[model samples]
Target: MFKTNETQMQIHSIRWLKVIDPDQEYITHISTQFSIPRNFIQTALDENASARIQCKQQATLIMTHLPFNTSSKAEQSVSCKSFAVIIKDHLVFIISKHDHPIFDQMIQYVEQGPEHSAEQLADYVYRFLELAADQFIVASKSVNEQISTVEHELLSSIKNKQVFKLLNHNKVLNRIAISLRGNSKVLNLLNDMQVVTGHQAAQHRLLNVMVETDQAQAMAEIHNINLSNLMDAYSAAIENNLSLLVQYLSVYVIIAAIPLGIASLYGMNIPLPLQEQPYALSLLAGLSLLLSVAIVIIFKKRQII
Candidate 1:
């Protein structure tokens, strides 16, 4: 079930309030009790969320990005957006325009058992953040595998047939890079929140998340650079092959032109000095054969054949 902040609070237990708007009467009532700023509540309710931790005169404001799957592809990476304002001991408010699996799971947990403590709520938040980070690492590995496959195809056998596939891989890599960057920002915010909240355990966990994200980002960048270089190398190789083809064609043209030149001269109607000599045709044939042989030898010696 999707968790919306309109649920009523249970007796004295840590409340899981999901509100669509900070201006709602229910939200205002809680704000008064929790001493949370109306402005912070409003920002939390907005659809576009940023990673931030602000300590107002009233309560701590925590905004975090949660992962959600939007694609039908089996291996697709989930998209994420900010879910904000985890007010202290009393309320854990989250606002999101879309459904998230982890958030949904949390809601189920809450519904089945509504006895979650404040520390448990905080732990849940940290767990969700870690899950999101883990997803980033998983997505990175998928992208890396695709890159490896494409690179092998590009290097082992250069073919126009696979160009479209390579382009698609490039597009996927770009999307993964963008997601990684966003996840990195979220990790940084989590790290900062851990510091502000003095949650040493959360801080340590987030540090590991940060390290994994950085490693994934680095791998992505390297793969991208390698793909680009391979494309360039393929282009150069193709161009060199075309140049060699042209040179071979040029050599054939020169060889054929030699016989054509001899024919043209003999075709002239004017009586030439060798025309009257017996065996002149044989002599011309011998000379033409010698010239062809010489050309072949010269080309072979120059390594142009």
Candidate 2:
């Protein structure tokens, strides 16, 4: 899907180009229309591209990651989406692979409108970046909650399935952490842009964007460490639990073998002395029971159970 919105500000025009799941045909059309490089378009279209910032063809190309949804809720998948912010021909161009909240907000903010000049377009850019940062924070919160739930489940019974779920959380947090790190760099570039931070209001907005990006980065880092530690700690704990169970089973077998050995000897044909006794059956049964009880009592005294 693709949509275009153009707002003619007093000093410059604001052209917000939003694309979602663009195919080859759509990418080609937008590339030719905005004179945006095909490489930039292709990179944005790729699902696994790394976060980056580049300048090409007299325009600033800002490509970074955003959290995206997937089909499965249980999986809680988080993938990266790319967006480019380019200013050219007295217009601002935002090229993205998916339709995002920032895109909608910018479109409405300009259409209905706040009054600003060509230079103030930086405010729009920074605001969008701020919202993008917020997305990461939001995702981290959800991931943290899910991690807590999985940790609880692991506590009750450390199953392979639960561990896998925790592993998935680890992977997701790593991705988010990497994304935020890259974005922190890209956002720093915004601070250096005179046009983006020319006015006081624009400057403040840019600072807020930077703060949000930092907060998001911090959240990702903290949760990632937590999840990693959790998996390791629980893995060792689970092994210890298994070891205790095996020890108990070994004790049980040793105690049980005593009675079995006594019964086996009585069954042998060579046991003629016991067979000749009038109360042989009663004596053998009594002897087996007494020995089994003694073994159990000895184990108890040693606290083997």
Candidate 3:
């Protein structure tokens, strides 16, 4: 039931099976054809699956989350998807829900020819891990740019939408961080298992994979910290702005009450100061204006306005 686009390659007498976005029927076929434990395959294809390695008598399964889609469109958020590689004797199966570009590179690597060994197979796995780490790095950079854009917008003027965008960006960064940590754990487990044993070159490549994974993890953490701080500062700023607004409104209310009080007194039928003066209304108006101006000037001098 495999599609034509799916590939099964024979390299140096070793069979390589690569499936892309397999369905239930395809999974059934793979399970029946290869006798692989169904859970091994399912775990790899599960969207929310974390990085893991499971060893059984029949097969060794290595699964890690990779950047699923890295479209540069501003509206699209970064995400990771599971990619699993299973090795049983001379047979290797690579499974993923999305046909990542790294798979293409692996196909080329397979075609280029190399002596097949556990190290070579491990190297194949390493390539998947390496590419995942690299993708995380790219995602971190993209997120940093987005943070900058949001910060710039905030600097010019604060808006509710921009704050919401900050929250969204932080969420993306947290996802990346969590995925990187999972991948790092898997890579460390692989190193401890010595899957590439006795091959110095492969071991070195594995070390690079570990280093890259750690670096990506570190970047994600740093971004998360910076984003957290930014959000805290933004919240503080919003509070400060609100406080200032309330202060200004209070000041204006007090200033307006002066005129209202004067008007109320003049409207009363009871005798008031200077009521019989011909220019009493004009005089009262001038008094209200002078008092309002004085109060405003006092607020300004006290740095309250």
Candidate 4:
């Protein structure tokens, strides 16, 4: 029953159980072994779950979105997943669908640091939130870099690919913004709750987490607005370029049609003015050229080109 890839460690005076990508059967086993609320675990596993906190009996459940870098080093994009933390008196169970680098960082910090030895389960929760906020900051910086790259590329030439890239960045920013708001809500609730306020240390840590959460949220919002404006400007430029191209094409078509209309009269069976003249072909050619030039001059004076 314990054959799964779950990592159980002793952090300070509490037992930390980290479960990744657990099956329903394993979740049932964990729920039975640790007496955790099964519903909390299920809620965390949900892909569409929002950040929230709940208390049931002796267990407290904290759900938060964990942001991860879904892009490679050359490119930057962010994606979020929900994770659940169930805190009992001496046991802390963290359940998520996938492992995050933040978890490893948490373990390493606890193992190498002496200051956190006296930390409680609530402190770890705050630390997790702070780390998550830091990830958002990193992601936001990456987005800013990407926007610069896209702008440079657009200056050279605009293409469908660049438009798609902007749309993709917009989508990522939207998700990050939403996740940050949810995180802020959870942090606010935790800060006001008696469970955190009663403990001075925990309250201080919670306040720090709250500050980081707000910063991340603000960054996301600012970046999102900038991205929206960039997209709008790009679209307007593209439309203007297309309109200019059509105007030039129309000017050329009218110039060409003047020559064609003059030549077409010679095709008629009736006695045309230059149809029988010995120098008619040369005169007609000169007339067409002259008329085309005049039309161009008229268009230029009107600023149609």
**Worst lDDT 10-window in candidate 2:** 3-12
Candidate 3: misplaced stretches above 4 Å?
1-17, 69-75, 89-91, 99-101, 105-120, 153-165, 196-199, 260-287
Q: Each candidate: what lDDT?
A: 0.63, 0.74, 0.80, 0.79
Q: Cα miss at 208, model 4 (Å)? A: 2.5
**Pick by TM-score: 1 or 4, better one:** 4
- lDDT (tens digit, per residue) of candidate 3 on 1-305: 54424677786756777888777777888888888888887887787887888987668888888776555666757777788888887788888877777777776677675666545766665765677688889888988898898887775453567778889888888888888889888888888986444366667878999999889889988998999999889877766776777898899999999999999888999988899999988999999999999999999899998
lDDT for 117 (candidate 3) = 55
Reference-based TM-score of each model: 0.54, 0.80, 0.79, 0.79
Task: Return the top candidate by lDDT.
Answer: 3
**Candidate 4 whole-model C-alpha lDDT, 0 to 1:** 0.79
Scored by TM-score, the top model is 2
What are the per-residue Cα lDDT tens digits for candidate 1 across 56-131?
Answer: 7646676655444455564444354566746665566655555455555655566665346554555555555566
RMSD after Cα superposition, model 4: 4.0
**Candidate 1 least-lDDT 10 residues:** 1-10
lDDT of 1: 0.63
- Residues 51-117 of candidate 4: C-alpha lDDT, one tens digit per residue: 9989987888888887777778776677877887788777777778778888777766655645444
Residue pairs in candidate 3 whose N, alpha carbon or C atoms collide under 3 angstroms: none
Candidate 3 lands at a TM-score of: 0.79
Whichever of 2 and 3 has more lDDT, that candidate is: 3
In candidate 4, stretches whose alpha carbon ends up further than 4 angstroms from where it belongs are 1-4, 69-77, 115-121, 144-171, 194-203, 229-235, 267-283
